[model samples]
Target chain A: MSGSSPGSIERLLGEREIVIACGPGGVGKTTTAAAAAAIAASRLGGDVLVLTVDPARRLADALGLKGLGNQVTPVPPEVFQAAGETPLGTLSAAMLDTKQSWDALIGEHAPDEATRDRILHNPLYQNITERFIQSHDYIAMERLYELHSSGSWDLIVVDTPPTRNALDFLDAPARLADFFSSRLLRWLIAPSRSTLLGIASKPFTQVADRILGTQFLADITEFFVSLQSMYDGFVERANAVSRLLADERTSFMVVSTSETVPLREAEFFATELATRGLDIGAVVLNKVLPTSLSDPDALAATRRLAQRTPEMTAALAARLDVDASVLDRVLETVTESFEDFAVVARREASSRERFPLGGATLLTVPQLDRDVHDMEGLLTLGSYLLGS
Target chain B: MIPLAERSLIFVTGKGGVGKTSVAAGLAQMLAFQGRSVLGCEVDAKGDLAAAFEAPPSGFTPVSAGENLSLMAMDTEASLREYLKLNLKIPIIGRIGPLARAFDFVATAAPGVKEILTVGKLCYEVRERHYDTVVVDASATGHIVGQLAAPQAINELVKVGLIRSQTDWMLDILSDPRQCGLVIVTTPEEMPVAETVELAAKVAEETTVELAAVVVNRVLPERFSPRAEAVFDRLSSHEGIDALSEVLGADSASVVGAAALATTMRRSRVQHMNTLRAGLPAGTPLVLVPYLFQRADGHRATRQLALHLAEEIDR
Candidate 1:
């Protein structure tokens, strides 16, 4: 094994009840989460569910499925055979349906059929459910908490939408709480309260009514009135998510690459997780360049190759019917090939310095020559992730 | 090549972590260098553009970045507030703090409201002639299509009211190919290339914006000679290790490994580049930006990328 044991990731998969994979977008967060969940299911002998927010066709392609819907799709035994791995336990995945989840949440939490119908049919609710800020994050957390408490799977792997920063997901519950508790909601629920305040505020309502227009204001007032009875249900759900995330069995796997911007985001995410006292299992750095060329002897070898530029040009000139001037350029290409490795080695060294992850076992996956387009690639990546 | 400099509003978006911010900044710099007053706006509210330029945070207001460049970090809340104050033209209680808070809460809950406000602000800036070129560093590809589509969606959804009137003007400029354009920035990798192809199709079908160009960032320059390939092929063989060791006067295994590693890097780059070229739409301009050996994070790196883009597009 390299420096970190292969069991580092495996430990998180087997021991923890919930594993959340998070990072900035395009760093292979979805692939990492899917692979780990699949390996844990097959190796650790437990039922695992991967809840992904991946785009429509991405998860299906990764899991080698025909198509994926919001419902759970189990990984078949044939897939394990195709991946060259033995199947043991069960593996299932579901892509989050943001709007559907919101609708279902309203149905589950509404005080009565009348209120539920009113809220569902409201133009504002219809619009908000589809495009609210971090609605995906908020609903995903709700779904994770719900599924976790249901005792359906031994381990649940949640993949978050790549937000502007990791803090958005961490801060989602509190932000939702704030939005729910704002004074505006109270006013919208009971506009009559404005008259109850004082005589000084009496004219304010008229001005607002005139500006927002009477119908729009009434629509806002009606929307809140219908949602007012369900406010406690929302607060309770949000609190449950917060408490679950802070629980001991819940673990977060921070994934990123050894690049400056991703490392910066990883640092921000890790630091925020630490501040929240959430357990960070490992910092999975993907697409890392090899550190071999940084050795002094390799550097000397590259320099030696560069020193033989004249002979290389002569040899290339003798081999091809080309002009003498083009031969030197071709020779530089040969010598500089070695120099390319040196450049990447130096860049990775500098990139490593910018990484903020500390104390947690750092797992590095070397850059693969090809993109993982199928289940075979996922299994290979999973082996690397599990340190096999 | 896409005539990006001529467009009033240029949207730069791609998959996350593909250096969209830097590409947007580099495009802004390139345009500014040509004497066009550029407003580099980041719509996701990450505000990394200010940091990339080594300037203080631009907040939600436009801050002068360089001689001809300006930067703004778009905040949906702030944009909503401005929309109410300016567009609604309400008299007295509209300017109150609680009203803005109320608007923010309701708008945040409403789906297209936030997007309309954000894109509405950008479109407003464009129509106002605020800058010669307004380059927006948009959010990830998944959300950006909806952001760009909001004006047209609202235009179709709400036929009357002040909202409809406001979105109508924005939609006119957005759907007009001359006024607005989109540039996709992606690495020469498999997933991003696949995503970019899908994105191009989606933007075409869902929105009025045009896909102006595709900037293939961080591409390795494959300049290997036949002799170099032959040498690498020999070093990869069993007996060639001893030959390479004799040639280098050092340990052959390490030298061979380095040579093979170099060859692998070049081969992968060629494969990715091929995937991108073959996959993207025909006749669409593909601008190849060389991979910077240094870290692509700082202002210097961004300016260097800008220079490369300037030369590539001109050619």
Candidate 2:
């Protein structure tokens, strides 16, 4: 991994159990993670699974999975063979259906038929189940742990959400556990124990009569009323998920660009992971600008050409178009704008240089000329990841 | 051509999270104080505009935060609901609420859909002339590109309808330099500075809207004098160390910190002003806002920002 070149991010996938890829939106985390998995499975002949939580389904499309759900879909043998230079190993992929997972969790936890139906059918519950708050994240974690424990794959690569909120996906199990264990849930379910409710006699009996005018609040109360029976069960599951995350085998990777915001986010996330006592294995900086020019002489020539724009403009106007004033004006503008052009070109060159962030073994990948859309692109990315 | 007074929409957008909302609210407050009608719009779901005005999170409905400025959250749900009803020809039955909610859910769920909704709402406000100015706290560079591109996306996705027509109208407004302009906000940091340059190029390629100005915010104070560095160096030397250590031992960390602070300040100031100069077209004014000790959250801070903006605009 240390010997990996300036342009690629290498992975010792045989050694590590879990690899988490995280970064800000549009930084190519999904593609990078997929490529790494592809590399591991192809080059190393190790079974690999890539799990993506991005609702965008970019990874699903990249993997050529028709419709990805909670269930793992094995990549076609040919696809894996094509992606690797050597005989490829097995590849499986899944896109997490957070909502479906939540429903399944509830069904497993519900105390009775009435409670299960009440919880499952509620609109607010459905909405929240899909939202950031619910155990969608916890469920995803549980699925990852299940896959890892099953020994079905040698390497499991997880592509997390793009925003700073990606941390929430990892932290969700503990958060849900805290929410369940907190006094708030108890107060919501058994209002008799609540101090404020104790002051107001017949609180549970008068719940409906207290506030009916506000339709939104009433709708919310009704939604919770139906979900109450399964509350304790949900809490217990959340606790189990939290313990699963506490396992030492899982490692968090902070994915970022060389740019400030993503790098800053990675730094902040590192601090957060440290606070949570989670071990951060590595930091992968994707889409890093290359330091050296492909053609320094050509670049210098362009700089000179930009400087002698006036002569170029005169020559262009004389030969190309006498009557085309617009063309002549454009030529003249270009001639005068050579210095500005040189500045831009220089900046573009400098932007490629390594952005040194100390205390992290940074793996930087060069900016891709094309967008990642299919298995071929992922393969090319995989080669680059290993080569670099 | 409509008179300046009648051309009531002032759409303010720049690179994301660069205090565009603060600038918008400040501008609105200034305009409102001058007895002009103003509405501050937060097209982004983050609702930073409302935060700037110290107003409660709101949606669609403009809530007055002050005498002149009213803040609106621009509810994407409501916008999607109305859009579906009018454009998609969805029936307004109670059952449609679920469908509408689904659409809202899908729209929110879609990558860059929030941006589309934000721009859509903003364009609607502009076209309707709802206020004297609709200063949109738009999404940052990449997102704003998506926002501006949404009309074309919708135009291509939806063949012919009010949505298409509305999208067309918004595109016109966005593309017309006279009607709308893009104001870029940047900090002195390398990434933001670099992003600003890239964003300017991208925006120029996509739209005819003029680059109004680059607002360089939170510029640190220049504290290092030429003599101060020499004095500090001399004090640290062995010849002056005994006397200096007695006098400045406790304040050494502060001095070093101050020195580092000065270096950072100088670097930032130079980088910011240089980036602004380099990125912006020549003669495009660069507004430098001094760093405030406190966060720009409260009304007092916003008012100060407004005053600073007024000064910059005048200059």
Candidate 3:
């Protein structure tokens, strides 16, 4: 969907069915996803769904989520109306419950009720779903695929997991596919015998048995053996998920703050997406200092006021009907604070100029003084996000 | 709450991108600069250790970072190999390849196999007195409790094994507050504060490790007193700006506006900080690290932050 066209985030949201919002953590990725989805539904007119990882408590309430679940809940129409936006379409939000999602996938792909019950009840099933780091990534991908294929929502914006490595979710599907087909996995599930394959896996089992104890090994073996029954279903679903990522109907919006660390990570992720021929719809930078702070004349005036604070305090105090001592302190702080922020603003401007966008549209949101919690706050952010 | 430098092992964790690595690096550097031999390990192995120190890349093997700081990344495979060499007395050179592959597979499949190795290595360093202190840039809050509780989880899962036998000492070290502690770093913001509070609760509930301190990083300076604040509020308006422009011969609105923004940001952050303090346990030492408007996330920032942390500690 992203090519040689006049592509803003508004167009990207309208055009693509899937928009993957991913970047370094703690940079408002989840909030941005929610905002983008809210804006799309309000402006572009569709049933937009935001699949967020973890939202702030108030934000969850704003979306009408009482507690955690995989159920997609619709944001009340009155919530949007309160924000002064009459949505043309419905907005829905779903928190990605990793454990429940894995259970649901097994429910869908299980060969029968007996196998499903066995796999679900197995102790290793709980451990693997909860402890396996990559399990969340794979399930997130699969859930997106399932939701898209079900034709439930017109647009889906996904807030990716906060992975230590940025590429984990992107590579999760192919990696899972390969893992399912791995020779080692096949060997693990095969019945023990004197066959050549069995003999090769014997030493591994013995070593593992010695280290982990035979009971744990047996538990692992039984779990995997049960999981082997659904191997064909998992691999086909994984492949489909991988294809969905690369499809033209999907787009990626890489998000980050203007801070050095998160921005650098985001640029690397953006570059990796392009290297893999993925469409980068837009590179959104959040919490950028306002450009007005960087005005040269403003910096000069602040310096002049700071230096002349003592001389002008009395007269200025009289004119403004304030105490001279308080005015003096206020003048000093005001000027010094302005100078301090100017340095940061100018530095941010330089980083903005230096960031490599390739061909993706660049969107920036200023550093709002207040935290975004309710729909009103989100709409305030969404206005900036839509570049209105 | 033991002082940061006094703890034999300190796991530094926070929400991602809140300067966790830099704070870890700063704590290690500060201790090392104080003439204590320190070992710093990056648990996630994201190469942030090297970035924070501006040093060469580190590996499982320790490399000299400065006067007394040795930096390395946490590699469970290497830790497993070392454990076998010490405990089992296995030569393990040629045999370790396939053995490590199998172990890696098991580690991937099992719940606490990999995490125990990470915690075990740090605990081993502490017990052996290889360094005065070991600083770990541990996983973020989401994964930290799981990582720190690895020994307990292992004890639950593995009833009998070499790994089971090793859990006793790791648990002892983790259970002793004087030996091991957790330092959580956060900026005064909504999500980070919420996560920090939750992590503190989880640590108390699940792990034996003590919450040593909460370091609030990137706190903006508040320059306006109540009276000065009232004075500035007037200056932020249209009529007051005209008066300021008459005095300075230039429109002071932008400067005044920028200052107002900074003040407003700090004011809102004060509310979040109050909520954070309330959610945390009473008497928990709250260290404030002032925001740096200059360079960021580099060696220079690390040094500046280290100095700021020292001043806070001294106070």
Candidate 4:
């Protein structure tokens, strides 16, 4: 085991009731969340749930959530046993199904069944729930809120949606609440409710009508009117979800690769999270090259091996039972490959140095030789995460 | 399908962190290097496009990147203003702040209104034939479908309006393979390749834009032949390492380890490559860009990728 444990991460998983893994897309944030939850459940001995979005297929099967929906499925202990381990506690997972979550929200908040059905059947409603990029963010946070409030699990590790702006999901709840309670939305639903605002938005509507047409306006207006019944419920729940994120029990873990772009975005996200009074518990850098790649001795040795003098090539060939010419070529390829990867590893090292971690704990996971697609893979990754 | 570079407009997209902006800039740079006037537009205003060109940040007004390359960042607000001035003949554009807010309201409530502005602006440049090829650093895969299909969505939602009339020409350009196409950029990895394969299917089904080609970026090169690999496996033993250390007068473990790393990385990624090849339409052009060990940043790496792309397209 690596003795230099990322102690803060271990402490974070053990102590915080909620850990939200967020950062730029394709940086293994989803895997990081699952590994942390799996490790915490196995080590800390408590019920833990990882709410993920679009896990790799094999990983989903490993988690017993191949066709995940809103319902949480417990990962059977037999699956962990197959991975050659025993679970100390339950580990469950649920994938974020945005459309289903939206329908459920409407079902819960609508004034009556008829209103709910009308809103659900609206084409615009379906489009907004299904295609509105921001809605996914809002729904993920809302789902987290509902799960946290249920009091069933000791810890919940949530993987945020990959947003266009890394900060979009952070503001989604507040934005949704503001949109639902806005005077414009109110005026759109029923202009007579506010004469002053209605008079103000009239010319605006005239221009909009000319551009969007009366039919589009009527369709949109009808949709908003149908949604009016759920206004208060949405506002209250959204604000609650927003507040829940900032609660003391929750912490944010920003995940990124050591590559410059993702690292820069993760730093910005961490800074933004801090500026918003959210606690950044740790930053996990995944798929980092080995430090030895940049070692001076290794670099010098590769440089020497690159020459492939006749004496060295013949000796290497005899030792390896290959022809001298083939050995010469192999040595050349190895040296060239080493030097090439060394450049990237050094770049990663310098980028890691420049990361502005502030007070957050830093954790780095070396690049694995293969894709992590099974429970054993997850646990191996989890062990690296735990430094156990 | 039309050759990728022959298309009048190309929207380069992929999962985030997969070098979509770099590919778009590289493709545009390649065209510019060929003496064809090119415009590169960043759809999300991320500034990474400008960084790819090693130029200043772009805006609604195009910034000249080099000889024949000009880069612009898409601004939906600016696009809306331009639309109003040209289409609505609105003289008081400066004073339409309240109306803009109303537009914002509808754009939020209705999904495709904002997307149309982004697409409409790009299609406008194509329609004007202002540039030989206009390459767009478009939204990530998650949102590109919504953006590409925005015109159709508007057609369905709006019965009669100025926007209603705008979708026809855009659709004509987008649906024609020779005029407009989409290039999906991906690395040979699980999530990216999976996303690419899925997105190709979605593009075929949901949007009218032609899939010009697939650019597999950062494909790790195999440095060893089969016989050489067998030799390497034997040489990796401790006895061979001791002999190697004696010859080199230093530890050769990492030097050898780097090769092992390369081999395994290449081996794993080959599966993704095969998966990608098997999943695409029978004849989709697959372009490969080698992994750059040098920092993949600025104009130098962009040029290297462009050169690689040139070779692939010619082949």
Candidate 5:
């Protein structure tokens, strides 16, 4: 892909209202998404906001900020300036706290003041809302919709949870919603009613039964009874969150390493996204080994040394013995491994060749020597994002 | 020499993203080659173990990666379902499929339940004697500690019956130095070596499993000697140096680069080895594996790793 051209990824970003970057852990999704947003904001002269749900708070660290909560914070203009780029546009970022988001969601969805007070105050409700239902992976779409609906920026970029199946993050809102809407909630609530009725009708009998046998089960049943009202409220909010995620404004950008497992995950996540009618803007294959060797003569000399050194030659022979192939075959295999990796790189380059969305574009970032840690790394990534 | 038949559970763990899965696969293959029935288990949900065995991603069922080596990728859902069936005595899981699925999902939603379920399943495999040797490609250091400590964690939560009994038994086995062995794998780099030392200390404090040995993989071989350096220097300034220089220019850089890398690597490796030697017991051995030029993928690379491991284990 030409550095100057609007690659498939760039176009996709330009056209989509929301871009979700998803991948496995430690694959540079956060940095990549941040860079992409920075690129769109600076190069395209569009307003961009990047939202990240990783609890590690690494995104803010990457962007050279103190901390980010639910509110959008403008990235320092000096960061882009340091990278030799004038800030021709604006970029903002926010780190989503799932617990805070859940609390906000409850406050927004509560039916009445008394209901809200009762629900929010209940320990059971707090557990379900703050702990059980507040996972970043499950609430990604909620954050996306929250950012999208604000109308605060022209484009929104979301850094998804780290998982092999990126679509799982996309599917979480709906899955949680389904759990609440399903009959399981009724079952959870039922025992409470039965216990209350039994208390009203024959308290002594039930109490004696509990004391005589099944004491553990009785305690568990009592705990479930206390949680009934909160469970109902949780179900209602989960439904609302699910509906917002299934909307068409959302697009997925799968980030992965060129390694087999990561690529396979990308393929799987892509298929899952397609099944859910979510548009896969592009597959951002990260950490691809450069196709052209920096120096070829060095490779030939190393090959010659392998042929000449007794110890090295012995190691090579031992390696060949396990595989049991002829010299020609061994050379062919070695060549093919390199060629296959190049093919993967080419495929990634071509896949992002054209942005499917009219105004959006695709882009590629070459592999770097070190992991992205501080602001300098993010700036390096940012430069790559701008196709520098 | 210790007979291969007596070895029961081989717990292989390393720093995250190292070739732990590959090492586990090679170990299983080597054991299988010696006619031992082996089961290779990967606790991570990435299902790379299935990929190694060339099996589809539905990973509950064990698939044969080789003649006597079988691979199983632990699925959180399947494990939860089985746990519910066994613990709650809910037989018709299909009839209440939604509830079953919900329970499975909710159970995993709890903080450390997933780790517990994974480790619980592995313990089941070990206790059942389904394989003569079970190799666990456990989670990274932090997660592995939580995983191995699950039995104790669950013991505190659930007080009676099979779960408690099983937890007790598992803890007993893990805490016994003779029954279970913990092999810490590391690269000859500073961070991984540091992490390995910390992990070993943590394991020592929390559990009774013996620190069998440390496997330092991916060490750069020493490539230059004093004589060779002098010869290369002379060649650089010799009368016919220009022609030879043109031919060997890139090689010179490569050699220099390799030498520099080796020097730094050797220094760090020796420092780590010394630290480990001082910290660990007197008898605990350290094994160093040279970095293979090839990537750790496919059966060929796995076999090569097995050969390297054979030397280490034999010692």
Candidate 6:
């Protein structure tokens, strides 16, 4: 079983250079990642960047910025100052532009200008970059590698794309290789009648040409053959990305709430991370029901108070010569409120017990009465996360 | 009301952790109960719908999960093989393990191919008239728009081929409102509601899939009447607290604390519900699924949601 005491997230923030926050959607994973980066920059004295690709754009609004794009923009010092914190280091953030990153990756690796233009302008490649299922996943890893290699930030926090797709980023390299190494491309790209291999594939080509019209085959062959020179670069980059993710300095953090579904996703994420041989640093359990009222003595006291409510109301009514029914209604409402909290607190605790991160650090963030949408809110969350 | 039986496919989607799977399962059961042969399907999902329906875990082929309901979990690899076998009529290649693996690798690498195959298979089921309804517990809201648009996007790239033909059929099924529609699930919260509204607009812009209804899950019940609210307000006032304190003595603090918490909870719930309604597209049908205060059990809770949907659909 995981220990009951919440572990310090500040310690991990100070120690790890790369923190990847992964979890199901709607669990505030992006906000938690952004808060971690902001705190690490202001309180711990290090340059930090929080990279997010969330379509919801909550992170941008939370940071009080009008918008974010592919470019890494510095978070104005005034924002931090307004929250009563002066940053000793720099805090910058960016949202990944999927297509721009894909275009850039190709531009940097293509063998020549002609190859680059051919692939860039190819209708099929254009469709692939825009509509490919894993383009977002692959480009996210590509950008992370680029930033990590740039060596500007002392610490970087990644707000991974939500849910299972985030896991797709973890295995992107292998999947990318599988796509490139498949024999189908070889058959498609085979030179026409120049070698014995070409003659051997003639029948297959005929069938393919018939099924997918001659023009279709020609387009596909052009798309694949144009990239033949840059295939090696893509493969090597994929391998480098995999290595970067598995590096000792990289840590994976799972963010979740104490709901049954989110906890299940947390456990699944932790298990997947472990299976990938990556380091699991901490699990941030957010919006946990308040534990203050969960204590046995407190529960007994509240129960006794509820039981004595009618008597107390009667005595008050007699002393003040007021309507007893008004007091009675008010007393019942107050007592029921406490009882509701108690029930929720107990339910949340039981749900938390089902999370399976026994050996990993556990950090719990209590639910706030108001929604967080500003720097002050982030810092307040930071204090709770860092236990300061 | 959108007729569930008339549609060949229903794509249920929402932001994660908002009970999309439960809503899909409940809708499946409700449709099944109405004497329609329904197939509950999930793509790249972890047997959640299967467990919710208390059915055997699904494989590539649809299996009986309940009366009038069959279940299948679609994957890129399996759907790719199925697609190849159906399109190319090559049984030997699909039977050869290594050959099948190679095809799977090729399909995996190609972007939009997996999504096309998955959607294609669902469309294929409808075209074959195998089931009265195919309910897909689709991907999360963030990616579902892209998934739905993949086939048409690919069709634009490949103009003349078997691939184009297949994608055209898939698009046909998706664009026809009587054949296909979408059910968006959400919670009475700010982010989910906002996402749901944006998703509705995106779907309307990107695809022909019509919005069947918005299912609001975990809606907190209204607990206070206007009279009770006024009374609670008076009790919380300073002079009122002092007067009550004189009689209640030391117990006044506990009572006051409880009152504050209760007020906070009730106020937030009302705030969230109002936000949800305001953010949604006007005149969109809303199904209110109450918050189950008890611990959540997949099967039982799904049934509760199904019962609710049944009533809503009947109304």
| Model 2 chain B: ten consecutive residues of lowest lDDT | B248-257
The CAPRI classification for model 3 reads as: medium
Candidate 3 per-residue C-alpha lDDT over B105-207 given as tens digits, one digit per residue, 9 for 90 to 100: 6876788888999999999999999999999999988889889998998888888878888899999999998989899999999999999999899899999
Any runs in candidate 1 off by more than 4 Å, and if so which?
A1-7, A55-59, A62-65, A112-114, A192-219, A309-331, B80-96, B157-159, B225-231, B252-281
- Give each model's whole-structure lDDT: 0.76, 0.59, 0.86, 0.87, 0.60, 0.76
- Return the number of clashes found in candidate 4: 0
- Predicted candidate 4 versus true structure: per-residue lDDT over A1-388, tens digit per residue: 1234454478888888999999999899888889899888887879999999888787787788968588899988888888888888889999999999999989999889999999899878888998878999999999999999999999999999988898998899999889988888876677734442353357767777778887777667778888887888888998999999999999999999988778888888988998999999888899988888988889889888986589988877786678888778878888888989999988888887788777788888889988887788888888877766
lDDT of 1 by residue, B197-304 (tens): 889989889998888899988877765567556654644566655544555676546545655665676677677778778877787888889877755677898899
lDDT winner between candidates 1 and 3: 3
Mind giving the per-residue lDDT tens digits that candidate 1 earns over A21-96? 9887888998888888888888887899988886336457666445444677887878788777786788888888
Candidate 5, B1-315: lDDT as tens digits: 123335576678876445667767777777888788888888775767656655565377787777888888787668866765665565543545554454453353333456667777777777888888887777766456666766676565444545455576777767665556777877754446656777888877766566766777766555335443343333333322332234433233442333333344455566756766676566666767766555546777677877887876676
lDDT of 6 by residue, B102-140 (tens): 445335434566677778888899989999999999988
Error of 3 at A255 (Å): 0.6
User: Where is model 3 more than 4 Å wrong at Cα?
Assistant: A1-7, A191-201
Model 5, range A37-151, lDDT digits (tens) per residue?
8778877767888887542334465564555467678888877777667766788888877667766766666656665666566543444444332366665667676667678
Q: Tell me the lDDT of model 3 at B242.
A: 91
lDDT of 3 at A215: 72
Give the Cα-based TM-score of candidate 6 against the true structure.
0.90
Candidate 2 TM-score, C-alpha based = 0.54
| Residue B296 in model 5: lDDT | 44
DockQ class, candidate 1 = acceptable
User: Using DockQ as the measure, which candidate wins?
Assistant: 4
lDDT (Cα) of model 3? 0.86
Model 4 TM-score (2 dp): 0.97
**By descending DockQ, how would the candidates be arranged?**
4, 3, 6, 1, 5, 2
Candidate 3 lDDT for residue B13: 96
